[model samples]
Target: MKISEFVKQVNTTKDAVRHYEELDLLRPSWKNDVRYYSPKDVGDFHAIKEMQSVGFSLKDVQAIFNLKRTDGCGSEKLIQGFLDSLDKELEAVVKAEEELQQKKSKITNMILELKQL
Candidate 1:
């Protein structure tokens, strides 16, 4: 499909799609000066959004994509690398959760003190 149709199908803006194209994250073929996106490109867009939702930066997503393209999808090395990244992200999320819990506890105690005043 064309860019407009692809944008509507993906529920994203033209600029966003263009940006992804510029980043080499979305590969659209050009014919007669018009860009055309395929179903695979649509899948790529969803994969990009899903990764971002999980707190992966565009650079991180790019690296993951690159690994998949370089090594076959079923390559053990790619699986190991992705697993390592997931482990690191999980650690960061756990640490952030602990910090948020500490802050919540402090806020609850302060609220109780204010109620006693």
Candidate 2:
């Protein structure tokens, strides 16, 4: 389907489709300068969103995608790299959440003290 249609079907935005194209992460079938995403592109979009949810920057996600798509890399190696990246991202998110919780706790304590005053 066309980029717009794909975006609609996938419940994603056009900018996301364009950004993925820019990253070479979504190479749609092009005809007469118009781009049409196939089922593979849809699957890749889901993967990208999943990665982003896990805290991978677009650049990082693109790099992982490139690594996975690179002709020279073995499929097993690419899969391993992606899995490793996911692991690191998960760790980073956990750390960030912990820090956020600490900050929130401090703010809550401050609010309670002010209320007492």
Candidate 3:
């Protein structure tokens, strides 16, 4: 399919698709100055969006993708790198959750004190 159909199928904007292409995340085939997207491209687009949904920045996603592509799927180094990234992200999320809980507790205490006044 072409860019139009691909965008419709993916339920995303053309500019988003173009941006992904610019980032080398999406590689549609070119023929006579026109780009043609395959089903695999659609799958890649969904994978990119899924990664973004889980707090992966485009740069992070690109690095992960590049690592897989460069090192191949079965490379132990790639698996270890991916695990390291996930561990870092998990730690950050846990820290953020703790901070949020603390803030919520502080706000609750302030509200209770205000009620006494």
lDDT scores for all predictions?
A: 0.91, 0.85, 0.91
Identify the leading candidate in terms of TM-score: 1
TM-score of each: 0.95, 0.78, 0.93
Which pairs clash inside model 2? none
Which portions of model 2 miss their true places by more than 4 Å?
71-74, 111-117
Q: What C-alpha lDDT, on a 0 to 100 scale, does residue 5 get in candidate 1?
A: 99
List ranges where model 3 is wrong by over 4 Å. Answer: none
Clashes of 2: 0
- Error in Å for residue 32 of model 2: 3.1
Sorted by TM-score, highest first, which candidate order results?
1, 3, 2
What is the number of backbone collisions in each predicted candidate, taken in the order shown?
0, 0, 0
**lDDT for position 69 in model 1:** 89
Which lDDT tens digits does candidate 3 get at residues 1-117?
999999999999999999999999999999999999999999889989987876888998898889878999668878887788778888989999999999999999999999999
Q: Mark the regions of model 1 whose C-alpha exceeds 4 Å error after superposition.
A: none
